[model samples]
Target: MKNWIINQSLDHPGRTVLISLILTFILGSGLRFFKVEDDMMKLLPQNMESRKTWDKVKEEFGNTEMIFIAFGKSGESIYEQTTLTSLWDFTAALEAIPDVEEVISMASMNRMDSEDGFLEINELLPNRELNVIQLEEIKTYLDNHPNVKNRVIGQHGDFLNVIVHPIDGAPNDILAGKLLDEADIYLGAYETHFGGAPYLTGVISELIRNDVMMLVRAGMVVMVLILLLNLRSVPAVGMVLSVIFLSLFAMTGSMGWIRGLTGSDKFLFTLMNTSMPIILLTIANSDGVHVLAKFFKKFRQTGDKREAVQKTMDALMLPIFLTSLTTAIAFLSLIFAPIEVMTGYGVSIAIGITWAWILSSLMLPSLIMMKSWNISSRALTSTSILERFANTIGKVVLQAPRKVLMSGLTIVVVGLAGIFWLNVEVNIQSFFKKGTKIRESLEF
Candidate 1:
């Protein structure tokens, strides 16, 4: 197998490159179909008891998710006439939104009392404009009805919360946007915050999309810079980047293909899977770097590009294949994970690693054969700073093997001990930084 690959790459380098590009393009075309999965419930185990109960609840109650819009003023009461007017207006606007089943706020609530020994129920805010006495009456009613007050008002009477319930299967993202727009129009002077599962779902979806684009681009840029510094050749860096890009394209595109073929969203990208591209970038780059470094060293010795390519493949092929295989197997272990999203993450990443190996073995070698490298005697004889640094570390390890072993063991021991202190952050809010709008809204 190795001889066949080497021969094809050397004898018909163009054909080999053409085949690789054709395969990459065909597989990568599916990228347009890729979609993001932001529903956190999908990440949970389908058969879990809690999950089953949640599903049952949703089945009976129909989208129990609510979007809470809280209005407040710093160091002031929400019972003022102007604040009450704005709150009433905001409640009406929210109720007008499509898919909104109910809107609960101080303005929307009913006032219950006894008039002429008969029970009476009337609008909590009968008019948008309230007099001073009417404002005090509302305040007195809230103070008496603690349960109702807790639902619509803040703990300290500083904020009024409007809870909105949307119909089942409603698009929360669109609805949240409309709700926020109305809040801006009606309660622009007051401090406003949003919460509840529906609002969070919408915000997290946008964040996931942003993160996928930003992190992948950033990772690619950083990898290119590092490759340039280490390889010190534009062609060499390009070859490595080609493998990385092709691997990522194949990985993401395969997801779309899987979903299209099976009609299942199980393989869709999720927050947990966001790191897959970065992982592939690092691993794919490693394989290409190994091939290029070995080829360069061999070419310096033999001064024959063809012989260097053949010998480089012969020496490193088995080792690189085994490394990628073992890494993929390690990730494949996640197939047994309870959560469906994690299982998908494992399978997708495993496929990515396999593709990376294939490209590094075939495409990279073919590219090396096609390109002409200019290697001066000075360049051949002189070692790079990275090589020197590696050599220095090798010498230290060889000179005091026992001391090095002890230091490594001690570090591992400390890491093991530190596990006890490590906290598992399951809060979705923790995904955002402290001052981020989403985090602040959730905290509020």
Candidate 2:
């Protein structure tokens, strides 16, 4: 069956291209469903004790993430009429946001004071701007009530806090941006700072977005450079890059389709998704190098491109299959992790690596077969840098076999020892480089 497929590809390369294109189109269309999520709880196993407690709390509280805003005026009391009015208006604006369930600030907070020996509950600050006497009275009341004052007003009565409670299932990332934008409107008159889970989620989501774009583009550039310098054949580089691209596209689209079909609320592989393209690129390019090297070596012996491809495919079939299978199995081992996030990571990466192997076997060979033999002929005659490096390594290994074996053993032992000292820490701020907006915002 494998030989027959290779013969078909060699005989009718156009048909192979057409079929690959159709599959690519179908899979690529699913990319639109891909989304980035930053929620940490979703990545934990459903039955994990911490996750269970979080779910129960969320159930009772209807989304426990709060957007906390600190409002303060430099060298002045926040209870001043102008600052109070701005705070009131900002609170109203926040309440008007679609996902916002409640906005608690001095505008909506209740004040309890004794009136004629009976208790009177009223808005902390009246609706209208307060005169000097009223402002003094409010400050005096705040000083007397330590519990309310400490929680709602800052230590010196210079800052007021506005807490925003989002509706259940509200997208915190989107809501964070809305809250920041609304706060910006009132920030001209006061120094406003934002914190809480929603803001942090939004910041981390942005960092992930930036990291994915930068890393994927950079990885491709590095791969192209290495392939061109080592292979010294444009067609070979093109074929390898195309295989990598298609493999990534298929993996991403497949993930999106799965998420959409299952109606999964949480994106289980947020970090894994960001890193998948680079991983696929490395795997796809490694396979491509092997295939192309074998094809060139065979072509040098036979001087016939078609015969060379057939021989290369026949020679590599079992080897590539076993190599890819072992790697895929290694990745699949992650599925056994106690955390669901790692399971998602393992499954997605394993599938992606498998897709890369399949594409390298089929699409890459098809592309090489379709290209002109003139470009590939020179590849066979020339001494590529990679070949020279391999030859040099082989010579060194032969010359000092015992020394090389001892060195390798020492390195492996050191690596094993280092594993005992490894530590795992999740510092969200470390996700972004220093001086970045997200990192600065988090620190501030």
Candidate 3:
């Protein structure tokens, strides 16, 4: 079987290629059923005190979607009757979004509009009564509360508050974008007075979405390119990506299966789906890089692509097997993470890494053998700095056995000692770099 994939790949590249495509399409389709969350509140931590305070404020008087609106006097003063009625209507319109919890401003304050009691505000303001005198008196009151004055006037002294909230149930970028979109339109009607989170959430959603998407996309591209660069053929990349795609599909499909078997509609693992692909890819990276590197190096030395493929597997099988085991073990280490996010990350990545390892060993090699190694591209060429460094290290280990062994032993001892101390000193805050977005948001 080790001899089969590389030795026989030249014989039936077509069939291998076809099967790979079919598998990819199936996997791609399967990934669609994966549901992403839309609730933004998940980004906030419940246990943290500052976040709790922020949440309390939101619960009391903030709309997660529509944040703020303002009214003020300028020129002759906003105390005029016309300005009062106009601002009241806009406030009423904003209260319409079902997800919206609250909106506040001087006009709204005077208007008596309500999320709980809309008809009451309507009666107070009336259909035609412009509450100019009342509004003027309110403007006078605002003068004393200068802290919120900018939260209402202007070129010289206007009101503004930068607001923040997790979009309700906005776990994914698309729906978060929708909430921001709706909020931005509201802001436009109310001008800068109502702006804050509208565009910000949209931008943040796009950034997080695009960043994650880029990582997954770029990883796939890089992995495929790495395969192609080594094997120098379409089929090599095809084989690797096929195996990866299959393993991921099978894993995700298992999720659907689990839900079906349990009769649960809510996918418990959904939160982990976004980064699971990348974690699997990261796990695949170590084995893929090593195996393919050795394969191509052998091919280069032998000048027989078939022999090279054979040598690649023959040389690396034990190491690759060890790598899979270690990778899975490394991921399992995440179980110790204190936070729930880290716990989910660890579990999913552990499964994914194991999946990648299995796919690499089981699927890619099998496909390679079935394909019989006929690809139309140049052979693996020139080693650059990394290969040289790897070679230098390999040579040092091989030539000086006693020294290498002692050094390796010492490193292991140190690593163990380090882990012991690390566990003692470990703090969750450290993994998150100093002043990270999560931290900054918390501080805000």
The lDDT, on a scale of 0 to 1, for candidate 3 is 0.53
What stretches of model 1 exceed 4 Å from their correct place?
A: 117-120, 377-381, 425-429
Candidate 3 Cα misplacement greater than 4 A, ranges: 1-33, 38-90, 111-135, 141-157, 160-179, 186-207, 217-275, 300-311, 333-338, 341-343, 370-389, 399-444
For residues 373-434, could you state the per-residue lDDT of candidate 3 as single tens digits? 43333545566455777789999988998999998899999888876565553432343345
Question: Any runs in candidate 2 off by more than 4 Å, and if so which?
Answer: 32-35, 71-82, 127-134, 156-158, 188-192, 263-267, 300-302, 375-381, 426-444
Model 2 lDDT per residue over 105-188, tens place = 778888898899999998778766788898887888878888878867777778888888888888877888888888788776
lDDT of 3 at 403: 100
lDDT of 1 by residue, 348-374 (tens): 788889988988888899999999778
**Separate clash counts for every candidate:** 0, 0, 30
lDDT of 2: 0.78
Overall lDDT per candidate, in order of appearance: 0.85, 0.78, 0.53
lDDT of 3 at 343: 47
